[model samples]
Target: MNEVMDYKFVSKETTVNEMIRGKMRNIKVITIGVLEESTGIVYPHPISEFIKRQYEFYGKSL
Candidate 1:
């Protein structure tokens, strides 16, 4: 089983407040695709860690 990771460094409340204040800010949501070799299928996956990292990065910049 894949272990779930907790994003301790990022603050969701702060991110939301920043977005609310930056009325014209553009927010891009990205989802990574996971490929299953056995079935030769690609599935869209949304990883919290990956997305939160972006939020954390942007939050620090702000």
Candidate 2:
């Protein structure tokens, strides 16, 4: 059987200089990083447009 878990988020206030900022530039690069450290299945990208087109036709979601 599967188990469900609940999580709580704790946050604090801080200044911009105290925080670090960066960007991956691409999600593919991040995924490659994860693969380097772990073992898992990964799907090839450039997925079909059918799902996207359907979503747009009906309504786009967040």
Candidate 3:
């Protein structure tokens, strides 16, 4: 089976305390996605490992 999982990374220019202090700053955010494959409709932890392995395999190919 084929599936996809979404992951996100966020960066804040100011700390929460700074924000509370009324400091204005720009916030940056980044997002990434990883496709997960499974043998069945439900994805188990083992299947997630498989996806990681696939990535490692292709990464080494480079």
Candidate 4:
């Protein structure tokens, strides 16, 4: 038997003074889905475009 789970990363941008004002930044939501096989192993989709985009951005920064 196997189980599957999903993960997501969300980011937000706000002014430094927002903390003093007790305000939260607008969240940019990113979702990632994973598949768990019968071996209890999880893997992300190969065709996922987000992963590719992120990798490209990271490589550029480096």
Candidate 5:
């Protein structure tokens, strides 16, 4: 028999920096959740529209 376990997805983010020309710059980061089931493993799931909209409300940019 196969046992099923519930998995919880935790979302996290970090700022990435790079130096170009002579100044440092930050880049935007995006992420998505992955799904796995008895059928197959999905590399990624669609990003949430709500999350995308939240970016617009941010007080500052990375």
Candidate 6:
């Protein structure tokens, strides 16, 4: 989502918001619904935690 949102980071027709709506939203579904059920990874955490980690990573990129 951050990459898609950045004009310089990635040049694409879709905005970050559009990618969030069209693509990124399913990340939680896939993580919690399928991957967790199969692999038992900790990615099944709360969405807020994921957003926090994204912001943390983005902060590092800056």
lDDT digits (tens) for residues 1-62 of candidate 3: 22234322222222222242587665332222232323222222343345545774575310
Q: What TM-score fits each model?
A: 0.28, 0.22, 0.21, 0.21, 0.29, 0.20
The C-alpha local distance difference test score for the whole of candidate 1 amounts to 0.44
Per-residue lDDT of candidate 5, residues 5-42 (tens digit)? 43333333535576868999985545454434444444
For each candidate, the alpha-carbon lDDT, in order, equals 0.44, 0.28, 0.33, 0.38, 0.49, 0.33
Report clash pairs, candidate 6: none
> Candidate 4 residues 1-62, lDDT tens each?
22223333222222222232577554333334453433443344443445646674566310
**lDDT, candidate 2, 1-62, per-residue tens:** 22212222222222222221563332111111111113233332232234434664576511
lDDT of 1 by residue, 3-50 (tens): 232112222212222254647555544334555544545555546446
Task: Please identify which of the two predictions, 3 or 5, would achieve the higher lDDT against the true structure.
Answer: 5
Off by over 4 Å in 1: 1-31, 48-62
As for lDDT, the candidate ahead, 1 or 4, is 1
Candidate 6 ranges beyond 4 A from true positions = 1-45, 60-62
Identify the runs in model 5 with alpha carbons over 4 angstroms from their true place.
Answer: 1-28, 37-40, 43-47, 59-62
Considering only N, C-alpha and C atoms within 3 Å, which residue pairs clash in candidate 2? none
In model 4, what lDDT does residue 48 have?
A: 41
Clashes of 3: 0
| Pick by TM-score: 5 or 6, better one | 5
Candidate 3 local Cα displacement, residue 19, angstroms: 38
